[model samples]
Target: MSNKATLIRIAEAAGVSISTVDRVVNSRGGVSPDTEAKVLEWATRLNLDRRLFRSHLRTLRVAVMMQSPHNPFFEALRDAFSDLNLTMADLRITSFVHYIDVNDFAGTSRKIEQVAAGYDGLIVTCPNDPKISEALRRVSRKIPIVTLVTDLPDSGRIAYVGSNNRQTGRVAGELMGRFLGGEGGDILLVLGLQRMAGHEEREMGFRSVLRERFPSCRIVAALESGENRERAGQVVLDALREYPGIRGIYNVSAGNSAIVQAIGSLGLTHKIVLITHELTEARRQMLLDGALDAVIDQNPRLEAQRALEVLGRNFQRGESGTTGGEYTPFQIFIRENCPTISY
Candidate 1:
């Protein structure tokens, strides 16, 4: 009968104890660098396969909390993360999705606290409230937390995976100003949630740039649409009625559908310069239909991939990974170069 070499046999050949071999094979602690290398070499030569050793590998379960999955943008992000899970062979990723009414901060915070308990890590869109931030902080003390899409102010999150929203906003403002040809008139700003850091930064950057560069153009009013398309449409309708001289509109969130509908109903397609964020199907169609002037896209697929990469790196290193600084560039989509919407 032929004898099969065991892990102990490999350790003996490498002149080390079985415990040392165990440490090297299981990727545990307390092995000298030279001894670890020798043990690995001997194990490889003996074909001491370590595939079973993966049972000892730590499994990372992460939760991704966001608003309703019905939105195409969130759906795209979910799809991207799912694809990432299929591709990563070394790590096991479990994604937990929670749907919260976009404007209900308290409900979102409670959900976050609940899910944060079961997972090793969290990837979340901020809920824009102190309670949510407190919940994130409390949970972060136990596990790593990554902020996705929107950021929580003063929250000691590990990393933020999203675009430079303020820069994108400035770009929108610049485009709006140029499209207006320096003409002076009131502009209506339709927003989804004011407390979302992304939305807030975008609005602030847009306002700052427009005020400084195009002094004549005035943003007369900014209204929150509560993340509802119908509400957004109603708000725009009210704004148009209130400010008859509105020459441009800036949409800083997901209510582009409402903006387009309101503008269409008013028959002001060619009259107002409309700019918005995100490149969802609706926005792309609006751009194609000439109802929307331009869109500042954050590229949800890239953002999703980056979030996973960051979490994976943090798991491997036991700390936040380095920012390579180079990121998927924020894209400016206009009618001339906008991609066809598949969703």
Candidate 2:
């Protein structure tokens, strides 16, 4: 290995062939965008002095569209994304946050299209709809895109900075199983919306783990309520009333407070094992009152920070450096280790 990174070293670091590295570093062509970005990421990390492949860092006009305006967690995420003064690779960043109706696919697509030409980079938490994906694909042709929270992988975004939903789900399963202590019974997965990529992944992971490790635990139903609190509450109440054998619940999406209310109304504060997402104030109090079992939280501030970092790296170094393009580690909070902080 050379003290200064050579083409071979960069190729090895990037897990590509030397010729591919040569093509990317020398702009010789015949390299896919993802491969080029990975090579440049290695070059940047290795300090290889390959300035030819690196762009001159400029003010990045970044537009960030977070979750629905009604979601405080998403609101916090947006606030953090805009307020950060942090930088990576010496690039100056100016972020503009946009709120969109996650369900309004057409309106969201219009918003994306309107901002497409004006922004240098886009960070969005959009629905996994075909039209929205098409719009992102079109925009990504001109500027790099970093998906936040919800991923639009088919959209060809450069990188993602959000929870490893599947792993978080597995974490939930492991914890919930341990809490159940072999008294296996049915559980419910309440989703804020059906088929949201993030929620789907989490459900898959949770179900897979439960099947693999706890065969006796049955997932009776996977319900969706569009994140409507009242509907979520009703679903919970109905599930409780209908299923007498259910001993555990995993809410894979929003409306944690509503679920908690249903649990309280059913007087299941101690009888049922509840695992939900987000560490909002309602959830914090429930955890304190011991009304819930566990809360799976992905910090919006961290997600925002990683999104900005990846966006910077994507445009400047042609790579998204934050944890190999996966970022914002998820946390499992209980009353014992929960931090007492006001969001």
Candidate 3:
């Protein structure tokens, strides 16, 4: 058998054809730089003794698309990816973070198409809009895509790595109800984006729990803040003015700062039971100061790690198929148990 034939294990391990491996091993220069690098890495690991070039290794570029830094959660998520990039040199993976305006569907879709052309893989957190999904599906045809913090089930993405938002919302509902001590007053919901599937799922779960377990509590209104602090604060303030009986509050997305400010502005800081998502520094401080009652945190760092793992696995396997969703665990934090470390 030819020496190249014996390299089948390496080819399989690297998710490439034996002929491709042969070309990379012989330095014939037919494969893409990344393909060559992957093949060479596997060949080196296998100790193949034909012709190996260590200098052909190439860094794999990964694109991460998320919301603007106005939201602390996305900012933390961007930082998580940045930190991973520093340490992922061994894997030849580098991640670039990009923020997109979730409200502009056409612009966001175009951005994905343009940015995806230069990257080997994509990890994104966008609304569940048809345009965005179609963009993702089109991009998935060329490279692997992983949905972060939300699921785009029909987007042809490889996997979703984030928290079960529905369960998260349900937890918030129960906490709000219990915190209200069964007095049962109208509750106000401040959501980030109405198009975000995670936010909607959270709303569903919250409503379900309230309907089944806490019948006395009712949702007065669900206002979309678009993750804008000023808008969040104004809508919250208006809701308070309109619904004088609103005694409980839950924010399914960002704008927690605005929520706190609005509540405090109205002198209802200690009078209302409030729960918000994510354990940002601001939110943590609010919890400590008795401004926020509790926080349901979906750790962005963990999600980043998991999404990278999924991409790494897909690259090594050299194939893509729906692997279903990977649900990261969520944490509920109260003043007494909130962590002191910044995430």
Candidate 4:
């Protein structure tokens, strides 16, 4: 009556060698037809039902809807998520990573709905579009939903695991202001996508802090920097030309290279303060070279790991150790403290 299977018992009952039992159990196919039938007959009667054997050991398939490949920060986050996927073997979880075009909001929504049908759960970097939110609502009725990096407030996701973007924005704004020497000067806010809930929250936080705390610093312009460096650089250059009074830049997205290039072209690298998110090698070098003054990073590795924890708990029907959303703390790095490695 024991549920646990043992090779010795199987071999004795089948009147076969351990090797034959091993072959039979593993489907290695060397026994005669009559012997194979006998082994299978006994195995079934002994409660060696393979499908039922694993009914309690579940496999949870989770689909991860991430961002376009163009954002360097997301690229780093992708790597972290991949590594985390490799470590989930013990939890019986597998990650299916899918990238959505940054410009195609409708396509992203469709993909989410399609992916939901195949996966047991979903983890997405939430988009601001209501279409995507509606898709999530429809799909989450069947499976659990965990919103990563970004969050969909009204979407009834089980939990959110990421840094608070608004706070990240506020920190960036405060740093940019203080680093600008507190003298009244126009500031620029650049983002990769305006419709991203994460970026919008960051912009909101940056604007609110600047308005309330840094009265001297004015946000003269807030513009989009396309995902690519070239497009981002061009947008920044045109913004620079249009707003020559810009004294500081707070990049809420992954266009730091373009913004840095434009600032360098205008010979304002040292004169104007630069604060961006993430700590890529390029950003680290920029920090060392005085091109960028501060960086706000939501440790992607931690975020990825926490995301798995939440999903794993949900799949097991266990407590997630939190009442509501869980946020990975953000880190602020200056030139002196910025680590040389990228995460």
Q: Highest TM-score among the candidates is held by which one?
A: 3
Model 2 bad stretches (over 4 Å): 1-58, 85-90, 318-324
The predictions' CA RMSDs to the true structure, in order, are: 6.3, 8.2, 4.6, 7.5
- In candidate 3, what are the lDDT values of residues 92-205, reduced to their tens digit? 578999889999989999999999999999999999999999999999999999999988888999999999999999999999889987779899998989799999999999
Tens digits of per-residue lDDT for model 4 on 1-343?
3423565565678898778766766677788878766665455455454443232354778888888656777777788777876776666678878998767879988999988899988889956888888988888788888889888876668888899888898888788778776686998888878888888999999998888888999988888865566777787788888999988888777778777888889887787788888888889899999988898877888887788888876655433323377888888888899887876
Clashes of each: 0, 0, 0, 0
Candidate 3 lDDT for residue 18: 85
Ranking by lDDT: 3, 2, 4, 1
- lDDT at 243, model 4: 90
Candidate 2 clash pair list: none
Better of 1 and 4 by lDDT: 4
Better of 1 and 2 by TM-score: 1
Model 4 deviation from native, Cα RMSD in Å: 7.5
Model 3: how far residue 298 lies from native, Å: 1.7
What stretches of model 3 exceed 4 Å from their correct place? 1-56
Per-residue C-alpha lDDT of model 2 across residues 1-343, encoded as one tens digit per residue: 4533488788889999988887776677899988887877777776566454546224668888766657667767766865685543344678888777777889988899897678888888887899999999898888888888877788878887788878888888888788887878889889876547888888888988898998888899889878666888899889888997789999887777777788789777778889988887878888888877898888887787787777765654555423335756777789998889846
Q: List residue ranges in candidate 4 displaced over 4 A.
A: 1-56, 318-323
lDDT of 3 at 302: 89
Cα-based lDDT for every prediction: 0.77, 0.78, 0.87, 0.78
